[model samples]
Target chain A: DTAVSQTPKYLVTQMGNDKSIKCEQNLGHDTMYWYKQDSKKFLKIMFSYNNKELIINETVPNRFSPKSPDKAHLNLHINSLELGDSAVYFCASSPVTGGANTEAFFGQGTRLTVV
Target chain B: LAKTTQPISMDSYEGQEVNITCSHNNIATNDYITWYQQFPSQGPRFIIQGYKTKVTNEVASLFIPADRKSSTLSLPRVSLSDTAVYYCLVARSNDYKLSFGAGTTVTVRA
Candidate 1:
C-alpha cells in the first residue's frame, strides 16, 4: 500500500485560474507538510500541520492556502495562480517523536503547469 | 533549522562506492542529520538519519563526526539506477519544519 498519495498527478491551467491538490497519508502520522519544488529542483517547505493544527507557515503568498481536515489529510488550494506557480508540489508526513528527528515519507508529487 | 552545504554534483561508475559529505557547522545539540534521495519527477525519499557516530541502513549509511558539524552519506556498489539527488537536512527532534537545500546530484554511469 502507498503510505502517502496525492491526487491529480498532473495539472495544467491557465493564468489566473485556481486549482487544488489533495493529499492523504495512511501512516497515521501526526504531522503533514506541503513542499514546492521549482524548476531548479530546490525543495522548499510551504506549510506544515501537526495533528490538524497549523505549525509552520513559510513566506508563501496568500494565494496558497493549506487545509487539513484531520491528521491524515492536508490539501492545498491556490487562488489566482500565476505563471510562476508552475512547479511540482509534494506531500509528506512523519511521525513526531520527542527524540531525534524522524524520517519523512513523501508522495509521488503533483506537477502543476500554469500557462 | 541548521543550514546544510553539500556538493552540487558528482559522477560515479557502477560497482563503485559513492560518498557525499554535508556540512552543517551551526548544528545544535538537539538537531539530527538526515539524508534523502530524489529521483527525477519523483518526491524525495528518506535514506538514513543519525544523531552522531554512524548509522547504517539497508540502502545507505550515514557517518557523523563527534563535533556534529559534518555528515557523510555512503552508497555501496551503486548502479545506474541509483542516479538521484541526495539531500542533507538538520532539524530539531520535534520540529516538523524541514528546510532542504540544493541537494547533491549523483549521476551513476555504467
Candidate 2:
C-alpha cells in the first residue's frame, strides 16, 4: 500500500488559473507537509500541519494556501497560478515522537505546469 | 535549523562505495543529522539519520564526529540504480521545519 498519496499526478493549467492538489496518508502520522521543487531540483518546504493545526508557514506567496481537514489529509490550493508556479509539489507525513518530528514518508508528487 | 553544506555532485562506478560529506558547523545540541535520497521524478526518501558516532542501516551508513560539525553518508556497492541526489539536513527533533539545501547528486555508472 502507498503510505502517502497525492491525486492528479500531472496538472497543466494556464496562467491566472486556480487549482488544488489533494494529499492523503495512511501511515497514521500526526504531521503532514507540502513541498515544492523547481526546475533546479531544489526542494523547499512550503507549509506544515501537526494534527490539523498549522505549525510551519514559510515565506510563500499569498496565492498559495494549505488546508488540513484532519491529521491524515493536507491539501494545497494555488490561486492565480503563474508561470513560476510550474514545478513538482510533494506531500509528506511523519509521526511526532515526544513532541519531535521523525522521518517522513513522501508521496510520488504532482507535477504542475502553468503556461 | 542548522545549515548543511554538501558537494554539488559526485561520480562513482558500479560495485564502488561512495561517501558524501556534509558540514553543519553550527549544529545545535538537540539537532540530528538526516540524509535523504531522491531519484528522477520522485520525492526524496529518507535513508538514514544519526545524532553522533556512526549509524548503519541496510541501504546506507551515517558517520558523525564527536564535534557534530560534519557528517558523512556512505553507500556500499553502488549500482546504476543507486544514482540519485542525496540531501543532508539538520533539525531539532521537535522542529517541524525541514530546510533542504542543494543535495549532492551521485551518478553511478556501470
Can you give the lDDT of residue A89 in candidate 2?
Answer: 99
Q: Tens digit of lDDT per residue, candidate 2, span B29-96?
A: 98888889999999999899898999999999999999999999999999999999999988786688
lDDT digits (tens) for residues A1-115 of candidate 1: 9999999999999999999999999999999999999999999999989999988899999999999998999999999999999999999999983236578899999999999
lDDT (C-alpha, whole model) for all candidates = 0.93, 0.92
TM, every model: 0.98, 0.97
For model 1, the superposed segments whose C-alpha errors exceed 4 Å read: A97-101
TM-score of chain B of each: 0.98, 0.98
Q: Which pairs in model 1 have colliding backbones?
A: none
lDDT of 2: 0.92
Candidate 1: deviation at residue B12, Å? Answer: 0.4
Indicate the residue-level lDDT of B6 in model 1: 99
Candidate 1 chain B weakest lDDT stretch, 10 residues: B90-99
Per-prediction interface RMSD in Å: 2.0, 2.6
In the range B43-66, model 1's lDDT, one tens digit per residue, is 999898899999998999999999
lDDT of 2 by residue, A42-114 (tens): 9999998999999889999999999998889999999999999999999999886212346889999999999
